[model samples]
Target: MIDQEDVAALLGTEGPFARELPNFAPRAAQQSMARAVQHAITERETLIAEAGTGTGKTFAYLVPALLSGERVIVSTGTKALQDQLYFRDLPRVRSVLDARLKMALLKGRSNYLCLYRLDQTVREGATFDRTQASQLATIRTWSARTRRGDRAELAEVPEESPLWPRVTSTPENCLGVECPFYDDCHVIKARREAQEADLVVVNHHLLFADLALKQEGFGEILPGASAFILDEAHQIPELAGQFFSQSISARQLTDLAQDSLSECNGVTGAIGLVLEPVEAMQDAVRRLRLAMDALPERGPFHQLEAKREIGDALHDLREVLAALTDVLASQAERSRGFANAHERAALISERLDRIAERDSERDVRWYELFPRGFALHATPLDLAAPLRAMREQTQAAWIYTSATLSVSSSFDHFARQLGLEDPQTLQVESPFDYAKQALCYLPSGLPDPSARDYTDRVIEAVLPVLHASHGRAFLLFTSHRALRRAAELLQERVPWPLFVQGSAPRHRLLEEFRHSGHGVLLGAASFWEGVDVAGEALSVVVIDKLPFASPDDPVLQARLEALEQSGINPFMGWQVPSAVIALKQGAGRLIRDVHDRGVLVLCDPRLTTKGYGRLFLNSLPAMPRTKELANVQAFFDDEVSAPA
Candidate 1:
């Protein structure tokens, strides 16, 4: 085994960042984190670590992971972070360490190009607007010359444009090995590289997806990996909830019907029997869509029973799907493409039946309406058992690291959520001097967060802090409703350039904020974590309220119900702790580096008035705090005579 100190020296002041880059400072915290990671891998045990921001955590784990002789899988929370690890950070690590490790990046299948889908779309072109037509023309040019065929490489096309998904393929739409362009498949090539590399970088969604697939008795995608490291591990419980559940949407059924209509338009014999039922299925879908449109908003699946038209439509759709399945079974001599499509159809039909029948006991059924269409879903109430099974299935050293994984100085909440018991745990504090460099202002005398005027009061309260900071702040809200209200209020109040989240793409908004260097960014959930903005540009993070999951959300309700059945206090056991972790994540946005200075302004009155408020405050890093607006101004001004 490599000595931790010897390897730790490589990341010290005189090491990689110092020798290769001009402005690099090595701290003892980063070295300590790297040592912990190294020991976890070497000893073959599970470890949970909370390394605060500016610990250079990316290198803390990557340096040990690359140096360890065993193959490692580094999973991240977001694709942007994955790209950063693979493109930017890894090269810098290689510059100093002599580790000749081969690295590969594998994204979810949707990110790669499917030649068959592109060809099919072109050969059977549909009506397109001017923008869609231009976007396809650009994709066509790129397809002819690009090697990787990754969707992210198309910088010209807007991420939200509908043209991209039309050209790409989903698992249901993919023709698999029967594709004519199987020889040049980008997904297959990426997977092959992943199989051969010493280190593989993947996002958490794909990581759990592969785990879920492996449990179904498939061969492992990561066969020889001995160390499995997760960055932003706080997101695992929610993602794992999504992974462990089963779902089938109305759009999925509609897409199948449309595809069969295209395929069976000119065919004859028993195979063509699919066309009639497929058409009926399309009408049933139309009925379902119309019935849902009559409703005021989305509700649980049971609520659909009140609308007799929806149940009638489901019955019609189910009957047609059964007929379609029977016809496909009769055609035993069908081509490989037909066989694959039949398997997909049969599975989808069965799920639609289960969700429609509402035959869920341990699971929960819910529905939501989107602009495109509506989707009915059945998700498991508990994922802990499945996650524990995954740990047992893989004999690897598992290390979970994030800046905010613990609540009130305990990892019990995090561990229990994932069925992880008594794992080795470490909490490495941020090297930033929060005592001298930052201030946490929790104002008093605000209405209850549930009050109708809570958002209005919050705006009135944070205006002073924003004024003091000179518009270099992020007004992070818990919901879109609050975000809009705050953005509307702040736009008129502040003079500095204001950049709201939806005004541009996330990357563009951050860049514009940096360029303005004195702009206020109002963002919701996505900005709570995985965002890195250092220096004096972002000097404050104003959280409008405590970060807690909405009680009305289907997934959270299901989990809470399950806890109640097990005789546990869901509020104290789940809600408060979960809120604590989320609050820590939001607060972490401030004081990103040692040189950075900022104040965290939490306007929620509950932090001081409510009993559970102590838990949230205890989770934050220790900093000088105050309730007075004068002290807030002084913190920014560096005044010695400021009130304590």
Candidate 2:
């Protein structure tokens, strides 16, 4: 077992060996995290840690984790963090520690190219378009010399390019180890490395996929590891819910039909001409779209009652696809190529049938209508059962840490939802002087979130802070509607350049915001947590309201019904705590570093009106609070005047 004192000393060292390493400054929270990880590994106990921002928790766990001399698997909430550890931090630590440790980064199969698909596409000469044809030529040329065949190397190719599916393999389509190119497969090689490595880095989706036995090539990720570290662990519950539940979409059916037709030469064959069925499916989809489009805008589809016709059309389409599957299955013995096509068609048919069957559920089912296209999705009523099963099966030490996991010093809310029983929990406050560094302003006289003038009041209250800070702010909202309203109001009043979420990709928008110097970014949901912008660039964060899911939402309603049936109070048990965790995520974005300073402006009056408001406020970092706008301006003025 590793000694905590020795681990702390190693992390604090600033010698020649540690110069290039990301500085691991020891804060109170970092030391606490180190001790927790050490105790868990030695005692074989489960731990839930809530380390605030600026704690340097990554290095805290990494140090003791490396010293344990045990196989460790670190799972992060996002792909960006997974890449950061595998590419940047791991190498730096390995060099200084000089511990001959083997490490590998294992991503889902979608990240690698499939040689068989590439070969088939090359032989058949199915060019997507002129642009895609050129890109495919480049990929084919590069595939010969490539060792890993990782798709990330094709940087010039756009993500939405058609050639992607042609070159990559999905779980339903892959031939697995039986393929002739099995020895040369990049995915297999990566998995082989993971099985033997001392440490492995993966994301939450891949981790949960492994737990549920849904991963494509390899079975599980953590069977070899003695301990599992989950960073940004807040996302695990929702991801686990998704992996545990079953879902199928109309797009899958369309893709299957298209792929089946692509493999055939003409209108007749041993598999019969799939062209007629494909055309019929396409026609049904077009009719379904027209029926939905005919409905009034902005109302629930279920309210129309006319939606049953659309469902009937879907039923007819499923029957046609099923017939295609039967025809394809009967010819599987004739040719290997036909057999593969038939299997894909059959899976697609079954999935669509399931979707059609689920249309009657009380949960919110809606079609996402975009400029040129749309898709349908359905979420399960509750995710607790599957998540609980996953936790019970783990024999290794399980560590769940995030900057925002608890609300008001109680883990009961999130813990109960996750089915965690009596796990060790900790909530480490930020070491910064929040009273002197920031202000939490709740403007009076603002209309309720439901009122038409709410957006106007929010902008008027926040505009002064932005001007005082000289355009360094983050205007966060719970919905896109409010974001758009605020953006419009701000553009009419403020002179600084503004950045909206979808105007550019998230990474580019952040880069532009950081570099612009005069920046105000407006975003929803995703900007709440896992965002680190220290220093003067982000001096203020304005939240529109305490984020609460729409009461009419199908998933939330279903979960409520499930709870009610079991004789539980859904509000105290579900809604309130869920909102508290989400509010914590939004509020935690303020102070990223000890040197960083900012103001958090919450325009929602519910924090003062509702009895549950105190729970939300107490859950935030113990920042100084106020209702006066002048005090906020005065605080920023003082911060600006203070010596750097």
Candidate 3:
């Protein structure tokens, strides 16, 4: 067994990483985290390690995990990060260590192309439009040649194309082992590889899906690993709430109706029983969405009852779905396709009934409207209990690490959120010299974030900073409204290229921004974290406000009310800590490496106006602070004139 000392030696200055990798710079922080992770693995202890930006946390964990020779599952925040770790980082680490470890990458089933669905679409000649037909043809061509069938590999097809849904399968639609293409199933292949591998890379969604399965009676998708390292672990609490929550969407209902009709194509006399009710169910869904148009985008379930039309529409939907469920139940013995459809229909009907019952004490029943559809959710008020239960059931070492895990140097809030009772915690500060490489500039004289003209004022203040930095900056906003406004105002003013979020795929926009050399990118939410642009390409990160969860959200409102009822100051106990963590994520985008120098422009007046602002400030990397715009300009000025 590899001990903590062995883990340390591999990461030390004279170790394999340092000797073999040309760009690997040894840091005491990385070694410290490696040892901690090694210790956690050896003792099978719960560890919460907060390695700040530039700590090389990836290598820190990988070394110990690869050396420990345990069946390890590494879960990241997103599919992109999962791919990065598996396809890029893991191979490098294994090669350097010469560790003979088998590793595999697994994602949610939706990511892989379902050959069954593809063939069904092909045989049915289901073509919505010319573009969709072309896209499907492209997928068919690529599907034949692709080994993994991961949709991410097909660069020719855009992620948002409607054709993807027709060709890919969800849990509700998958025929599983009964499928004709079961022998060639990509998802099963991926899982089989993961089950046999020593290490598996996955995203949090897949990890939580497995955790959620214990309750769902669907057994886990992941291998029973000896250790689970959840990198970007800060996303866990919020994500756990989502995975744990029981949600049924309009799309699911419509898909069920459509798939039921598709299943009737071959079966004799099936269409007569299924087609009319399926269409009626589809119509009910449309009526429900139309009725919901008069209400707020989302709110407590009671709001549906408050509006008589919406209530009637929802009732109509339920009756039609129940009718469809009964019909499908009659056809269940006809074919595997019928059985799957029947099961999905019955399950959704049951969920709708369960969601209808008011469970205010534990779960919050809420509904959210979309442009084309809607979703009803029943989220738990207390996520900690379920989360803790998941960890205990695994009986494996749980190591949670992220740059933004702790708030104001305290893990209490995060710990309480995830029910990490006295888990061994470690905070390794970023090895970057923040004093020399970074500056924090809090803009002065801004109205409250609630003010109607807040976005306008923020842009007015940021334009000059953009000019000073020569347009190499990320203008991150808490809301899309602010981001759009800023983009509109700067399009004509800024001389450099402007890359706005939603204008293109995130990766493409980032690539353009990086290559532009002096580009101003306006983004919201997703840009806050897991984005890396080091050196001179990015020199400034301007946050429009403190990254607080909007109180308008149904989940946040319900959570806060629950906290208030429990005698906690919801703002300080929950909101403030969460926002501080978010701000750190946004600010972290600025200084990514030791050589990277940049200015973090915090436009939120609360940082100085409120007492709790210190929490946000303290949580950030220590950097020289100033309120003067001249200071920000001077910082960049020095960057330009400094010796290379």
Best by lDDT: 3
Off by over 4 Å in 3: none
Better of 1 and 2 by lDDT: 1
On residues 504-532, what C-alpha lDDT tens digit does candidate 2 reach at each position?
A: 77877888888887799999989987787
Per-residue CA lDDT of candidate 1, range 528-578, in tens?
987889988999999998988887787688778788989999999999999
Worst 10 residues of 2 by lDDT: 296-305
User: TM-score for model 1?
Assistant: 0.94
Candidates, ranked, lDDT: 3, 1, 2
Ranking by TM-score: 3, 1, 2
State candidate 3's TM-score.
Answer: 0.98
Model 1 misplacement above 4 A: 13-18, 265-274, 293-300, 305-307, 327-336, 357-361, 639-644
The candidate scoring highest on TM-score is 3
The ten-residue window of minimal lDDT in model 1 covers 263-272
Candidate 3, residues 482-548, lDDT tens digits: the string is 8888888888888999999999999999999999999999999999998999879999999999988
Kindly indicate the candidate among 1 and 3 with the higher TM-score.
3
Clashes of each: 0, 2, 0
